[model samples]
Target: MRANLKLKFEKPLVLPIHYNHIIQAAILKLLSDENYSRFIHDQGFKYEKRHFKMFTFSRLEGNFLIDKGNKTITYFDGASLQISTIEEEFMKYIINNVLLNEGIKLIGNHIQVEKVELKHMDVEEGGGRITTKSPIVVYSTFEIEGRKKTYYYNPKEKEFEEILRKNLIKKYMAYFGKEPKDKYFKITPIENLKESIVIYKGTVIKGWNGIFEVNGSPEILKLAYDVGLGAKNSQGFGCFEFI
Candidate 1:
């Protein structure tokens, strides 16, 4: 399930350039269920040794101005954000909490929930085209000289697709408690593949934003649509929309 939230502010909304963490914090705050919130935050659904929050969100969309000097972005108009999750319970809590609250805070800025729209996307057997709502992130970490270093992959690399496929498979197992019927899945960039660099909580995350052709099992495709593609999904990466 996916929810598109339209937010209004009495004054111009000012935020730092790296505000993904702020948006994440606001979402967690809106959860009315404290236990559920803590669970998703501290320890999500576990698969093997990995944890999957089973949710992803898009970057804020609206008119905005970037202040290089102050390192901030100010939104003159209202903003819209898309949040998705495979867990129905999480979606329910988000909607209920949003409707119940008169207003919410986004980095100390009061934001009114103007509208909330829900959408369910259907994936066919052959799959179809998709455009990223947030950049798709795929990477691996390594230890060198007792120091941890991360390597981010571009879409053109073979490892990028391989890692994404493996990630979807793991997510499938994590959510369904069994492997998908058909494990075949592939993602290829169609056009306008651009690298996106985002700094989340002081960590530099490299990702890609573009339109792509995805061919896979309908079940796996649907799961990717709901949970997001690639890695760091719960941190606001890999959100895509069927095009």
Candidate 2:
């Protein structure tokens, strides 16, 4: 299940651009500490490249234009928050309770839930990889090695199809707890893909933002769509939506 949430702020707020971890902390607040750690973090690296987080979210959308000359800033009225999970119970519990005690305090400003739009798509049993309608996938690969290197489509390294397929298989085993029927998948890029970067944790973290059609296991595809794709999903990378 997924929720399109609009957060109304009690007062205007400002913060550094690198606020992914802070948003992650707010998401974990929806669940119990044990569950949060178990599902969102500290998932034993028992597997090769899997982490505990089974969900991903979109960037906060609101006013962000800064006016340095005036020494003033315009704040956004609200922000849209999209949260999803693989399990039904998890989604229901979090939605019903995330706002129970008090609203989420994001970036030192308390935000109230103004609106919510719930969406759900279930993969039928025996469903295969490609569905009747294809979805555009945009994912940000995690930083590897000592430096941040991001790639959307680097033909020099390898075809995007091969890279995405290999990563999806690992994610399938890690998140779904089973090997995927198809070991490989394909990503047909619909648009010109390129590399991008963002300031996270006070460093230049490489990333990719583009769209593609995923050809793989239907169940795994849905899981990727709902939860996220690639590594470091909880830290906000790889969850995609229809373009």
Candidate 3:
């Protein structure tokens, strides 16, 4: 399921530029059903090389209200954000609670949600490949000699392209509990693809949010759209919509 949420604030939401993690944590706080959330969050493969969240979200969109002194952004009150996932119950919970709740706080004590509007999206399914209307973010990390390294996967780099492809195949297996072969889909970053370096909660992340082409089974492609296409999805990355 997918939803577009419009929130109005009494004043511009002043927050640090690297507030993505804060937003992610706020989303998690809404899931009061601890048992179900634990199942959804921790049921995935805990072994090496497979860590991901099932859902995805778009970066914030709106005119900025800037306060250069503290290096904070004051986003306009009517700004919007999009969240998506294949889990139907979770989507319902968001609409019924997150959006419905009055005066919810985000980022810090100052930013309060005065109003919310939720709109459901109708995305068509069944195609060999699909293009995203909104950019999809791709990212991952590697360890080199005991030091952590971040990678921004894009089609421009042939090796990273292959890495992304294999990573996605593993994600498919983890989600559906099926043993699937690699090459199930071909993910190609398209023209106008751009690299983005984001800082979330003091952690630097190298990622890309841009157009991508997916060639594979129609069902799998649809699932990719529903469940997002890459890692850190639940942290507001990799979400896509139909072109």
Give the alpha carbon lDDT tens digit for every residue of 130-156 in model 2: 311112233344677767655444422
Cα lDDT for residue 209, candidate 2:
58
Better of 1 and 2 by TM-score: 1
Model 3 clash pairs are none
Candidate 3 Cα misplacement greater than 4 A, ranges: 40-49, 65-69, 108-148, 180-183
Error of 2 at 147 (Å): 10
Model 3 weakest lDDT span, ten residues long: 125-134
Instruction: Please provide TM-scores, in order, for all candidate models, with all chains considered together.
Output: 0.96, 0.75, 0.79
Error of 1 at 57 (Å): 0.2
Whole-model lDDT values for every prediction: 0.90, 0.60, 0.63
lDDT of 1 by residue, 10-43 (tens): 8999999888898888888877788999999999
CA-only RMSD, every prediction: 1.2, 5.3, 3.7
The regions of model 2 sitting more than 4 angstroms off are 33-39, 44-46, 66-75, 123-159, 192-194
**How well is each residue in 18-103 modelled by candidate 3, as lDDT tens digits?**
66776777676666688867766676343345665667777777888667688787787556777777677777666666645653
